[model samples]
Target: MEKKPNDVPKPNKENTISLEIAKDWTKRWRDMESTYNSHHDCRAFNIPLIDLQEVIKEQGVVSVRGYIGVEETVVEGDTVFIEKLIIVGVDANGKDMISSKDGLILDQESDDIYDFSDPCPNLCDPKSPLNG
Candidate 1:
């Protein structure tokens, strides 16, 4: 006899724990981004952090993009975790400016690309003339 799909055991505990951790981290990350955006003179510019829960619910995958700083990665078991994503913001003159921690993270499975590279030189520098 074949078991029904609903008979399969669901990893509820694991999923719940992962969701909680993701929520906590997302809040902290957004707070940090808000502070950085405020001081960088990009009041009009916005880089909304993508909601992983929503993405997972809608697309069954965690994919997001925005101005985040730095790109650090770590491998745990078979999964690779990327962090410190920096989003680009506009300068006082409404020109795009890249964060000092700009980098890229490409998800092969999802075909999602997170690009934070500074197209203009020294945009993250405080003393850079382009900052104006």
Candidate 2:
């Protein structure tokens, strides 16, 4: 007959107690912050900290272009994830002219070709820059 009992060591409560406490604390904190607060949207640096290459790849843009289309690219809710580098061209007037899988223009200050991490954080509205 094969031996069945006393082979495996029983888990000790001492090792797991702190881990359980930590988990419970984390859950309680999450619950405490669950209420709606205006400050949630004010987190300025909402960007993820990662390598530029990975960011670009995640955005599905091989290269950046100065323009999003014939008109200058404007920032909208749509173009939030594009990498800032890879813009290719710009029109005679100051406007981005290429379209990436991500969205409108990536960088704003730069008309020259270079890599950037963030897209146009602030863009003038193409429809009416003055009114909007």
Candidate 3:
């Protein structure tokens, strides 16, 4: 799916962005690749997940502290964990490097939903999300 200009993720007040692939899109695109390079169409637009990550990293910073928020789910009363991840970065001296924090912006509006679980299970866990 095409990411709308406003759908871009952003950094928090402390300055940080999240890095995550659209799971469904990634899986589907990767799966199609496994079949017969069906992902060539996606390749045309250069919207691959890796490329997107690079853009995020270049534009903002990755948040070390994962955040959690409520998300609508396919199952009733089954809330999903909106994973807090990062994309932007800071220098060794701890300074904001990215000029545009827009890359770190997230769609946390009421209609914008996400999973509460950490997209990176190894990095950020439930505890962080819960407290976040």
Candidate 4:
């Protein structure tokens, strides 16, 4: 079947059955591996489940704390790092959102000159279109 863009597949009875079978097989494999490793002292390394959970929790806390306000912009030299560029309406809904361009301009005073006297063929001319 041809899938359209943004199409979501609906689950059926066959899919549910296959998913259950896969889960059962995975669990059995894990149990067998654990048993074999326990007696043989296998070199396979695995972090404890509790430790993994704690690490995940710490990561979530750090991510939440790292969030900056929408108006905040951190700049080092000529480089700018905008936290978030969003226009909010009076009702607290987002009107528009913009993202910063990425690239390190090594030399801003380079002698290279781009002639923009004619209208840009890419429709990205910064000058007023009505004037032209």
The models' CA-based lDDT, in order, is 0.33, 0.29, 0.32, 0.24
Which stretches of model 2 miss by more than 4 angstroms? 1-17, 36-132
lDDT per residue, candidate 1, 35-73, as tens digits?
Answer: 654444332222233423322343333333344332223
**Which should have the higher lDDT, number 1 or number 3?**
1
Question: Residues 33-89, candidate 2, lDDT per residue (tens digit)?
Answer: 444122222111112333333323322344434211111122553322222222333
For residue 4, model 1's alpha carbon misses the true position, in angstroms, by 44
Model 1 CA RMSD to the hidden true structure, in angstroms:
16.9
- lDDT (10s digit) by residue, model 3, range 11-92: 3432322323333322333444454333121111112355334433443343312222222233355533232322233445
Off by over 4 Å in 1: 1-29, 38-108, 119-121, 124-131
What is the alpha-carbon lDDT for the whole of candidate 2? 0.29
**What order do you get sorting by lDDT, best first?**
1, 3, 2, 4
Clashing pairs in 1: 67-86, 67-87, 67-88, 68-85, 68-86, 68-87, 69-85, 69-86, 70-101
Q: What's the TM-score of each model vs. the native?
A: 0.23, 0.15, 0.25, 0.16
Tell me which of candidates 1 and 3 scores higher on TM-score: 3
Candidate 3 TM-score, C-alpha based: 0.25
Q: What lDDT would candidate 3 get against the real structure?
A: 0.32
After superposing candidate 4 on the true structure, give the runs of residues whose Cα lies further than 4 Å from its correct spot. Answer: 1-17, 37-132
